[model samples]
Target chain A: GAGVSQSPSNKVTEKGKDVELRCDPISGHTALYWYRQSLGQGLEFLIYFQGNSAPDKSGLPSDRFSAERTGGSVSTLTIQRTQQEDSAVYLCASSAPGSNQPQHFGDGTRLSIL
Target chain B: ELKVEQNPLFLSMQEGKNYTIYCNYSTTSDRLYWYRQDPGKSLESLFVLLSNGAVKQEGRLMASLDTKARLSTLHITAAVHDLSATYFCAATQRAGGTSYGKLTFGQGTILTVHP
Candidate 1:
């Protein structure tokens, strides 16, 4: 893809249900990131992946949230047993090999927990 | 933990006016970035400040960074209605091996350039 791509641009689920958001990063890019943006708030870091390095998960809000990248091309963010507070926009971005490069962002998936 | 704070969380300005948005971080960092977002849209990268006294300008917007003070400023000159959007500043810090390239973002400043 010419740019970062995210799937299921919008998702709505009942509380306690699980949801999955997917991201397809730019080809050949080695760095990927996930962030959450609540209404009227700033972007909150969730996770980061740099090549084969174990993903940095220190920013994950809870154990219920986890992400995995397959083949270093596509990634998935799964929220288990969603809560109302989990409602937010999940954004994905990819950079060229390192953190020094500017990131290209996806349109993001807006998750709504009812 | 690197914490970032942005001032003037909400700004309503008349078009053609000049103003500045301020960002301050709690820790020392070498990289700073500015991004813009419209309502119901994704973020767009605007500028990257890599060193103290680094400055970058694009059209009506200019961004500057001061690593020593842990501060960054986004200055709007002769603002236009099309520039109405939320602006954010983020800082990158490498901590051990798990927090590399982790960007800490400050609360965004919602700017409305009114005619």
Candidate 2:
């Protein structure tokens, strides 16, 4: 309730199966971000949303990855036909409207593709 | 495209020792952020450096920014076992109203402090 919250802390799916990860940002936070981190790798930006509208999706790896936000509060990241390479920790963060504000992060969802 | 690089991908230090982690970016950015992540845990925001010469300190960690050099540093003072974690630095550049606040992150520095 006080910090960013992500659902399905751990998810295991088949290589071809699709999965949806959910993020509930801090109440009143207007900026939400999605990032993916592979094993022993740095975080890779996936997308960012401002008040239910994604301003930049360039960081998305491919067409199979998509995200959407509704009511300016909750967001979902969908991965279609997942591959083994897609296994990683998906992190969600939220911040205030200001550009200089520090982001508060969720515990992150660890996805495993089998 | 913005590229971020961090030096000393791994560090092992004795307790009470000090160290600094470096972050360099290829393009101009409006802000820099530092974060800490423990094993199997999500990141925790450590600092936000907004302008050149900006510096912020929390506990034993201090972060500084140099816009002209496109560099940022996280200095750890008197390291403790509790400070053992992975540290990351991210840079953000505003392209326009739509592409604002997108961050490009550096490969994290994994620090291990021994007692």
Among all windows of 10 consecutive residues in model 1 chain A, the one with the lowest summed lDDT is: A50-59
Candidate 2 residue-wise lDDT, A1-114, digit = tens: 588999999999999999999999999999999999997656888999888888889889899999999999999999999999999999998988767688889999999999
The numbered model that scores best in TM-score is 2
Task: Report the TM-score of candidate 2, chain A only.
Answer: 0.96
Q: Candidate 2 has which clashing residue pairs, if any?
A: none
Model 2 misplaced stretches (Cα beyond 4 Å): B95-99
lDDT of 1 by residue, A1-114 (tens): 488999999999999999999999999988889999996655889988876454578879999999988887899999999999999999998888554687778999999999
lDDT of 2 by residue, B1-115 (tens): 8999999899999999999999999998868999999998889989999899999999999999999999999999999999999999999888466345667889999999999
Cα error, candidate 1, residue A29 (Å): 1.4
